[model samples]
Target chain A: MANNKQYHVAVVGVTGAVGQKMLGMLEQIDFPVEKLYPLASKRSAGKTVTFKGESVEIIEATPDAFEGVDIALFSAGGSVSKQLAHEAVQRGAVVVDNTSAFRMDPEVPLVVPEVNPEDIQKHKGIIANPNCSTIQMVVALEPIRQKYGLNRVIVSTYQSVSGAGNDAVEELKDQSQALLNGEDPETNILPVKSEPNHYPIAFNALPQIDVFEDNHYTFEEMKMINETKKIMHDSELKVAATCVRLPFFYSHAESIYIEIDGDDISIEDLQNTLKDQPGVVLEDDINNQVYPTPLSAEGKTDVFVGRIRKDLDVANGFHFWVVSDNLLKGAAWNSVQIAQQLIQQPGGLK
Target chain B: MANNKQYHVAVVGVTGAVGQKMLGMLEQIDFPVEKLYPLASKRSAGKTVTFKGESVEIIEATPDAFEGVDIALFSAGGSVSKQLAHEAVQRGAVVVDNTSAFRMDPEVPLVVPEVNPEDIQKHKGIIANPNCSTIQMVVALEPIRQKYGLNRVIVSTYQSVSGAGNDAVEELKDQSQALLNGEDPETNILPVKSEPNHYPIAFNALPQIDVFEDNHYTFEEMKMINETKKIMHDSELKVAATCVRLPFFYSHAESIYIEIDGDDISIEDLQNTLKDQPGVVLEDDINNQVYPTPLSAEGKTDVFVGRIRKDLDVANGFHFWVVSDNLLKGAAWNSVQIAQQLIQQPGGLK
Candidate 1:
């Protein structure tokens, strides 16, 4: 029942945060790979990355690097992905992009395998991975939406620093130590690195995740709002998000409120639906004081869903606490899962 | 003309977190305090607190401690307030309780000075200070409500550890230091100290702010919901809250979404209303990356409001980022303001 043929895979941006996670996940999941190419920028080309206890030298991520690659995982920044993804596709390799460049493109399918695996069939050689915050939320809400139908969603996120890349993670650690030593935090590379006026993210929460648009919503918030509507295939669905970067280093936690289409939805109903879902784990046990936290879900692949409760005032409203490793389910693991799905599909890469 | 007459003031729980803040605020505002009594638990009775460069001895909080005391600010705890508030009231002290002991008592007016200072005139001996999260939110929203008429409120709080008192703050600091040193965190106080199974709050976000009730909502969430309705004097207002505890020490941040009663309400309208409102500062210049964070609002008296925007889908929906020092505007300063109101009233303590 299983295809045992191994294919050549290329992991782009191999020196960065999510790219490193992609290499680790590919080995952890034991993906069928005959050859591996670890590609990064010219500055990091000579670096070596470990895969399956074997050291692989990083190569430059150029257009010719995608030749003979069956699946290419791109976790570089948006510009790098935009410059090279089409080249990979033109070389007959399926591209799973982990950036915002192609996510809202109708030609590319934004997919969470558990929620919309069927959407991949519509892809034109490139599949877009949803934002880390968006991926965990859709995974937790899809079962509920399927059973009761969702009308509205309002989410507040406590995102970690790793989503910004490895440099931000180092900044958080250094700032935490400095603050604890009663020293002023050295500030740079947070709440949008390119923007002026950087604020320290250690022991603090920055309300802005990305640059603000004309509408006052940050780009990260818009990604959550827009990508959610596209991935769920419901443009009429009401979605709003407030994305904040916290001091945590790995996982992102969200406080989600959703209104079901009809009345009489119970906590048990939501719990049962989540428990039966493929990539969701239910951890809600209020009596034992059980719920999901970012630190607890740091290295986990599945989205941890907990804190399920019916709204006190709204009859159809329900609340949930969702948590997952941003690097895993939010980026690398989701891209690898798409690659897994691509290999599993009949003639998926032809 | 302002009254020059002084009054005898009592600061209950003087050795505790909010109690110390109350003492500082009383002096900072240059209140006409002829005499001051600092009361605390018996264990902390011998502690000395400084006021206006003078040291005041901490006395044990007892029924007789309020004798001839014109105004008593109670912040010790709920049980302590419940036991001694009436005793102090019987002794002719106008009690401004900071705990949830009598907030929803119907007879006890829950007052935010900027929002409903007039409600203090209706107080029968005791005026309850609303919950910290509720106080800042209502202060920011009251102006909008007065101008546009509010129909619904949905808030998610990123509350700090100091709101749980000094022990929780110490836990956060200790856990943070330990985690940074690569040691396992020793958890004792958090997400309700009375509840079993404490989770580390150093680098994590806990969804539970207080222990859960039968309906699966935490007591803290219910407090926000019920207190908002009562404080606004609008029972029909649809309000929901999901309160989470973060690792920050002083200020609490809220992500609030509100539906106005009428359509065509613009962000400019909301900004103009907030700009003119008392005790509320509008810091919403996204072009310069101006927004309030908990660190920036620490020790501030005003409720900092920003991130104001109109919802993309809901015609009347508006969103805001509200931040304030939970101990100041939320607890201590609000109580002191109520005391100030009491002093200005004719025959206030008679």
Candidate 2:
């Protein structure tokens, strides 16, 4: 059982939506683990989670909780990560954080395994996960960048309600039901949780996905803009984003307009390159109604790319639709992939 | 009662989605009438509708149904309109058709009351109501065009399922419930009812809104392209559309990009103009989360315009988002507004 001596991996905030998905992904990928610890807030301490066909009781997360843990996966809120993330790192555990608390830090590697796996080596004990919208987009664009150098990216996202958390999904459901029942709906948690005004997400589209930033872009939009450059390790890559929350419950979709440095590349050539890329699925047959939908990509880990066509007048511009499970590829699966990549690196595990 | 000796108006296909909205508009804005006839197919012939607090029986639409009618509003499917529209016109009724059946017909004047009310007089016998997407875009763009000539328009829509008809709404509802219940959902309509396959619209987005046409664009997309040109009465205008159906049930939202002939127009000037325009509400204050959303625009007749800004790196390009109830500004309210405009004109009455 020497091969089983991999690592004792602990999942912080195990009761939350993204944390649950991380556990499901861990089982799905069958990660090499010596032991698993499920930690949550004190209120959820005694709750049980099914991990790899075994029920594990959740423990209250604290700095002392990571005494012997080799890997700590953090999907808790940003405040929680800010509080305990350094504590976990101080105790000699490598932390893969799924919050924005450490993502922009100069020391933490904002990693998407496919796009910046090598960045993992430079992490100062804490590797940060890029925003969900940024994760799927970088996944689709990285291979393209490697093939044809990227110059600019303009993305408009159709994000799902689940990205706001489980409560937002329930709010959408309740509001839709209220509308159908010929009653007025009550909205308290969408378009931004901490914001004063709540817009109904049922049968509607909201242009602001997250709280507004001083630059006239929402925080969600800025994440895509800033995180893209950080993940690609190119501060000069021009990026803009318009993040929108639609009435979808799962999977985030984006319409991306990208300008490549090379002009002679036909759409067919780009399609051929994307078709062979790892963790990417091409669904771009426009004639036969073949394209990716958020519902179809709900439980899948692969980023689905389609609508690959040249822009009407721009010579080097290409437009495509990229969709992936924001909770999976955007969060849980990417963390697991990063862990696996860290294990596979030349310097063996501690 | 003697003052009731006004023109006799007939509403064909009165029981359908757009037809019902037309009826509501007729009631909401007192369209003068001596008598009103509600005509539908055999399936809805005997149904009773309350118009202006009076129960009006729906008559079966036939050639003789328009005998003494002065104005006819047709919103049935294309086949019904193609067959019955000519008959209504021959019977001295000025038919305002709301289907794609006559939108592209050279002899028909496609009208949006604000943009092309004068075009209503040019109708051979019938005026066409442009597609819902086109109606909203042109209404927002016409003022801009008047101030600075418009050269090109490229729009991508996040449309609602209700645009397909009442059945598509039912499919979305049923499929959502089925998916949430962990059951296989049924899909009998959508993307095109006559097409071979049906896809579940719950938690999904379909790129094709209507049947595919010879030009490789869906009929809905082509309808937007052709109808925009026709409604603007400028055949030389370059219009391109990508119409996508999201799971939204009410209002349609569009991201419109336009290139104007003038130079160096500031975003503030554009916002001020839209704020003063008729049937348009400006909601472009990004500092306070003041952007127009489909939920806020539902059941409203005004086009909610916001996110107005100059395109980056393009001199004459500007981008905006427009939202309005598809059933209102796009179809029913537009038809009724045209009728009111005609009534206000010199030769509008018999």
Tens digits of lDDT, candidate 2, A1-350? 22444788889989888999999988887888778889899999988999988999999998898888888899989998999988988998889999999999998899998887889999888999999999999999998999899997777788899998999988988887786677888989988888878888877788887777664567887788888898998988877677789888989998787889777888888889899888899998767778898988999999999877676556787778899999999999999888777776676543
Q: For each prediction, how big is the interface RMSD? A: 0.9, 2.6
lDDT (CA) per prediction: 0.91, 0.85
- Superposed model 1: Cα runs more than 4 Å off: none
Q: Pick the lDDT winner.
A: 1
lDDT of 1 by residue, B1-350 (tens): 16688889999999889998998999899999999999998998887899999998899999998998989999999999999999999999999999999998989999988888889999889999999999999999888899889998999899999999999999988999999889999988987888878899999999998778998888899999999999889999989898999988889999999999888988988999899678999999999999999999998999999999899999999888999999999999999999998888886454
Clashes of each: 0, 0
lDDT by residue for model 1 (A1-350), tens: 16788988999999999999998899988998899999999999888988898998999999999999989999999999999999999998889999998999989999999999998888898899999999999999999899899999999899999999999999998998898889999999998899998998988889999899999999999999999999999999999999999988889999998999878877888898889778899999988988889999988899999989887778999888899999999999999999888878886454
User: TM-score of the candidate numbered 2?
Assistant: 0.92
Question: DockQ for the candidate 1 complex?
Answer: 0.82
